[model samples]
Target: MGEIDTERQKLNCFRMRELGATVVPVKSGSRTLKDAVNEALRDWVTNIRTTHYIIGSAVGPHPFPDIVRDLQSVIGNEARAQMLNQTSGEFGHPTFTNGPGRLPDLVVACVGGGSNAIGMFNAFLEDKEVRIIGVEAGGEHGPWLPDGSDTDKHSATLTKGTVGVLHGSRTYLLQSPDGQIKETHSISAGLDYPGVGPQHASLKACGRVEYVFATDQQALDAMRTVSRKEGIVPALEPSHALHQTMEFAKSLPKDKIVLVNLCGRGDKDMLHVAKARGVVIDTDVKLNKTDFAQQ
Candidate 1:
């Protein structure tokens, strides 16, 4: 899901490599997804004839974003149908069918290249009663970064970004006065973008959707909460949405329903989360004997 810099998936990485996957490790500019994209773009240009770039996000250009939204729209459609048909069965989970059984009061998803958010929000545009909230990855909050820069350390584009052209599209971006792309930070590699999809910017300007941010700490805390409460370790990206959903839930009554897109699981983020909590992983024997041990 994310945690690209953790280097903890040694066995899986080796397996992928043995399957002929080229693992070009990115080693610059925060060593996150943004830098990995830069490297990928650089490599794509080297041999355009033999390579076709299939982006993971919905932020690139006009038709590409539309294509992704169309494909991912299935997510919203399925969620809608599932919620509509949810009923309390003797053996299945209980369904709170006290009021209207169709559609939730609120829909929440994290914004990483705006794919999941756009996908979920597209189906609820006409439903005026349903609230759409997009959560951005809010990284470490402090006085600038380690380099003493004067920008936020989080990748909160719609909340902290302005209009600009980036990644072959005009949208909201985080940039310097010289128009240089500033580095973005997030515990989740999926959200390490300095820019967002243009449609999200339009949604923000038209006030059709509300955008918020959840810090790394908040997302991590939410991740643990869901893990313990629901027995699901969510990816850091969706953890942002989960964190915001908790905040939004506090204002509403207990009966009000909120649908959170738990997009990806946390199978890929254990090492990153462990490192964040001051635990070291020694799968590769990189640490001392007294430090970290592999089970």
Candidate 2:
């Protein structure tokens, strides 16, 4: 769901059709989700009698944004309720609260397309005291600035992007000097993106959400750490989020409660992991810089 690039969305649509679902192909904006959205709208106009376009992210038309937010609200709502129930039962009161049932002091989630982060942050948005942190992939390193410097090649869009349209919503985008959209790449395919959702941009601007990055190595380490320690193989995207937790754990109180969104399973990334480790799939070999330089 990262940035809703047209190619990936089209593939997803194809898969849906393969699964025996009725599918109407939409090819319109970036010819991705944005275009799909436009097509859905056209379908609604022409076949208003029977069409339902499922909005995926937190940004869109009024009812859509609101609907998505409400749907995602379940995450925070459930986490808070579960925390209350568990802590109250254990300590005769909720630890997050001074006494009986209470709320959490912090919330965190990994963001790519940002729906999960938005969902987790929504419940805590009203509580001025609760801190929300959104973790993103560190595409590359450069000078420090929340808005990012010209030297940055990273795609932590919420912290370093400009207002623009991508995937059907006005949002923060990673664009080239010519204003063309630049494709984003990452070891974690799920986090690869050139932009962030509009809602996340606004939240970052308003200081309600703090953005951070986890490098590829750090994410990989976290993936390994979780597998070794908890016997759980987390998706690489959420491993990026888990990396942040490990970073924070180093400085915070040992007992601090940290929750990570283990977004998806890791079955899809075996090939990627193998590739990253230099496990060659084909016998094709290329000469290195040293060989060329010597020649």
Candidate 2 residue-wise lDDT, 1-295, digit = tens: 2234323344444566789987654444333443445566666779877877676666555566667777887776667656566444322324344322455555678887677788878867888877788888775452144574454544566666677886557778777666777655455655666667678888888888898887677788888899899989887788888888788768877655665667666655655666677776552569999999999
Candidate 1 has an lDDT of 0.80
Positional deviation of 33 in candidate 1, in angstroms? 2.2
Candidate 2: what lDDT? 0.67
Candidate 1, run of 10 with poorest lDDT? 88-97
Give Cα-based local distance difference scores for all models. 0.80, 0.67
What TM-score should be assigned to candidate 1? 0.83
Residue pairs with colliding backbones in model 1 are none
Error of 2 at 251 (Å): 0.8
Off by over 4 Å in 2: 1-51, 59-62, 86-102, 140-153, 280-295
RMSD of 2: 9.9
TM-scores of the models, in the given order?
Answer: 0.83, 0.71
Each model's Cα RMSD: 6.1, 9.9
Tens digit of per-residue lDDT, candidate 1, span 219-267: 9999999999999899888999999999999999998899999998887
